[model samples]
Target chain A: MKVVLHIWRQSRPSTSQDFGQDGKMVRYELDDVSADMSFLEMLDILNERLTAKGEEPVAFDHDCREGICGTCSLMINGRPHGPERGTTACQLHMRSFQDGSEIWIEPWRAKSFPVLRDLVVDRGAFDRVVQAGAFISVNTGAAVDANAMPVPKADADKAFDAATCIGCGACVAACKNASAMLFAGAKVSHFLHLPQGQAERDRRVLNLVETMDKEGFGNCTNQYECEAACPKEIPVRVIADMNREYNRARIKS
Target chain B: MNWMLDYWRSSIGGKVTMAITGLLLFGFLVGHLAGNLLLLSGPEAMNEYAAFLKSKGALLWVVRCGLLAVFVLHVITGIRLARENRNARPIAYARPDTIQASLASRSMVFTGLSTLVFVVYHLLHFTVGVTNPEHFTMETSAGGHNVYGMVTASFSVVGIALAYVAFQVVLFFHLAHGVQSLAHTLGLHHERFTPMIKTASVGVAALITGGNIFLVLSVLLGIVEVQS
Candidate 1:
């Protein structure tokens, strides 16, 4: 299959960059490219070719390639992860494209996640947000039995849905406003759903939203672009949940 | 002021106001698009439509005033809500890297302000006949009725035409956020309909912006010449 790859290449984060300027559209013609090969694996072949030619390999981050890790992020053409719903970049297959298709691959362009080298971004901001307490503060001395807590099925389902966030940062990349409310809301709602987390529910929403704001993430304009771009399909309802929780906390304070 | 704050915070009044005003703007966009579509019929059609608007006298003024009130209320309530959200988190997050969001969502306030400026300029240039010099060319038709000649004349100027295009682009961004937010404010942001709303809003904004840009560019390029 012949594929014209328009890949974004950057030497360093400090260097001024443009889509196809600092980045070049490298063309590749290959035979017997498997449809089942993951997008990263396909990239592996491209990198191999570059390495053989004594050229710098295209630098993209992928750890697991199993879609569990959110590292393999790319804006394929105008859509994220090649227009597949509920899937990461690593899970996207070559079958999604025709043989003669022109693929435009670029790193996530958000102010918060500045490019470190090439496709690799400093996603440490997500880690810092989580460290700000995206969990219940519970002691391990007396572990409560699962049956003892007795969470309702509905609340548990909601919590599980919130917990499904893989911290990919795709929501931020997709949103026109660059708002992290969906991500922050997911984190806040995950904890707010259970009795164990109820103790810190108010504090959690307040702290997380404050943290999100301080980190320079934009406010949710309810455009739901985050949800649309989300690989996990996280609902914007979680944002409303966060808003409700924040309002409650404000009153209590 | 305290009462105002309470009203803004206590009930769903703030949310309802945001939704209602947003929907009004939405309605205005439809009317504006309809009015602007007269451009496709050539300058005479557009001008005649504009003159008709002027002849409405007090009724036109009443509609303008109503639109002004809606716009003011929407912007004010939106600002207040954003401020309240900000105040909810006075302290900075200790860990800043845990969440990854977008620039559009982050710079909404800035984009919104730019759009506001564009809106005022738009009204002054076209509606109030205060900004664009060409807008003064409007005159009565042979039937002793005032007809719209100013709009086509205004579009003839390269600077005004370019400004209109730029402002329309800003308007697209504003609508992209505003329309979807309106749905959320009204509690209609279910998963099934949310995407439809977002896509529809973007499409509508694109159409409006594209149509206006095309009209201005056609006029500026002499593709569509205005009548004497």
Candidate 2:
């Protein structure tokens, strides 16, 4: 298959404009590429070609190309990880592309996630939000019995769902306001649903949410863009639960 | 508690304030609509009702002040949130195909601002009696202050009636998104009942806007009489 990649090229955030002056979409046409290649593998092929020509290889982030690491981030065309739902960019196959088609590939577009180079962004803001207090303070003791705490099936299931978030920042990229509510909400709900996380429930929600806001993420307006764009399919209702916890924290304090 | 002030200053706090204040305003809208519905019952009933409300004196002023505070808070929070949202996305997407956000959700700020403008114009036209002096008279019958005459006369003007109807349309957009968003902001949503909540939001918005528009049009159509 022949694919023409119209990819965004930015030098770096330090010397380049964040609002469009220094960025340009450079096109590279690759012929006889295998349709069986993963999107990341296709990018690798392009990088190989660019390196053979002694041109600088297009830089993109990809740690675990299997999609668990959440490092393979790309806004293919206009979507967070291309048009397919429940799939990250690394999992997206080249078979989805039509022959001789032009695919627009760009980095996550948000003020908070600044472009580091071509198709890569610094997503440390998410790490900072989690660092605020999305965890439980459990004393390091002997491993407790696995079935010690009687957990409801519903709650356990919800906690697992909330726990599936990979910190991909796709929700922020998909949101019109670049809100991080989905990510923050998932972190809050994950802990709020567990008995192990019950001690500092209110503090967890408040601090994490406050940190998210301090990091310049936008407020959730119930747009559902985050949910739709989430590769894990985490619901936006988690955000509502986050609100409930934050309000409860305020009232109780 | 300063905790509240601090919470209210956060992102989620702004949203919570908007949710709570919007619901308060929604209550006021329903009550005001019910009171205006009395106009269809003729001048004696409407005037008596208006007098009853006015007779509360101190209680009425307290309620008015509280309502004003709620209204102002809702507006200020909404404006601040909208501004922050705009700032979050400094670089616009070249091709953003919004699959999830409704047109109403995105246009909330515009609708809310339009409604705010209409509220000011409304206070001036009817409450302050400054927009149309001839129409807004204080000298009608019934021991009360001619409330029924004032309402009918102001709504009878074609231009005023059209403007009211237009604002009513904007109010519909505001309430439709505002009500459903309250569910999320207040943490009252469930996956099983989301569609139902959205439907009810639209239904409530329509009832309020349609009911008020019906009253304005009835006066314009001469379906109701302006008691002398």
Candidate 3:
């Protein structure tokens, strides 16, 4: 099968042109495609061709293509990871596309995560947000017995739901205003649910929120775009929970 | 105290004010809508209702002052938050494939501003009688302002009634999203109750707008009258 992909190409950040002015779309025609081939495999084929012609291959972040690492980030066809819901780009197969379709592929677009090259964005902003929120100080010792601390079944399950967030930054990419509230909410809720995460609750919420704002991410407008694009299917309800946490912190010290 | 101030100053802090202020204004809407519905009963009852409010002069003024304060705060916070949101994303998407946000969610500013404009226009047209001076400034036989006479006269005009109803469309959309978003801000989420909340928001928007429109159209079409 054959398909045409309009890939965003940026040699550098400063050299800009066109709408969304960060990058230009460079068209690539691939004649040999297998429906069974994964999307990243197709990209691998393209990179091989580009390298053969001595042209610079597109730069994208990906590792653990099995989808656990949350590294494979691509805004394929005006979406965070193609059209399918709860699926990452690496997991998306060529079978999703029609033979002659012109697919527009771009990077995760955000001021916080600027394009370093082609599709590779500096997602260190996410790390900083996580660092701001994650503050668990416990003495180093042998692991405690599972029965040492008793947690309700509901809380345990909810914590696990939030704990699954792999920090993909898809919520940021999918949002029109690029709000990071969903990402922040997941982290905040993970701590809120556990007995271990209770000591610095107020500071954690305040610091993470302040850090998120400083990172230049937009405020959540209850759009639920982030939840929709999230490969892990993180619920938007976590955001509402985060809002409560922030307010409680404010009413306190 | 510093922490509290900083909390309010945060972007989410500003949203907290927005939610509270919006709910306060919606409370006022219920009272305002109830009072206006008196137009259906003719001049005497409506004028009496107006006098009842005027009788509580000091309390009325206090409520009005509070209303004005909240209104101004809502506008300021909304504008500031909107500007910050815009600043957060300096670059526009070439083809932003929006998935879940509703049309009302995206158009809050435009609709909100239009609602604000209508509010001013409405006050001038009825309260101060500046917009439709001849029809708006009627005097009651009891030596009080003829509130019902003024209201009926203004709504009798086809152009004025239509213009007012058009603003109700803006109000409907604004209230619909505003009410729902307020629930989210307050951390009130129950999957079973969300549909109920959404229905109630729409119902409130409809009831208020529908009540106002019905009163105006009744006067215009002679279903209600200025006469006893």
Per-prediction DockQ, in order? Answer: 0.08, 0.68, 0.59
lDDT per residue as tens, model 1, A34-59: 77887888889988988999999888
Off by over 4 Å in 2: A1-4, A14-21, A27-35, A97-102, A139-143, B142-144, B226-228
Ten contiguous residues with the weakest lDDT in model 3 chain A: A13-22
DockQ of 3: 0.59
TM-score of each: 0.62, 0.93, 0.95
A16-53: candidate 3 lDDT, tens digit per residue: 23324646788999998999998999999999999999
Residue A212 in model 3: shift from native, Å? 1.1
The lDDT of each candidate is 0.71, 0.88, 0.85
RMSD of each: 9.7, 2.4, 2.3
Q: Which candidate leads the pack in TM-score?
A: 3
lDDT for each residue of candidate 3 in B1-228, tens digit (9 for 90 to 100): 776567667868888888999999999888999888888777788889998989999999998899999999999889888887776666655556877778878889999999889989988987778987876657887678888888777777889889988888888888888898888888887779977887888788888888877887888899987442
Candidate 2 or 3, higher lDDT?
2
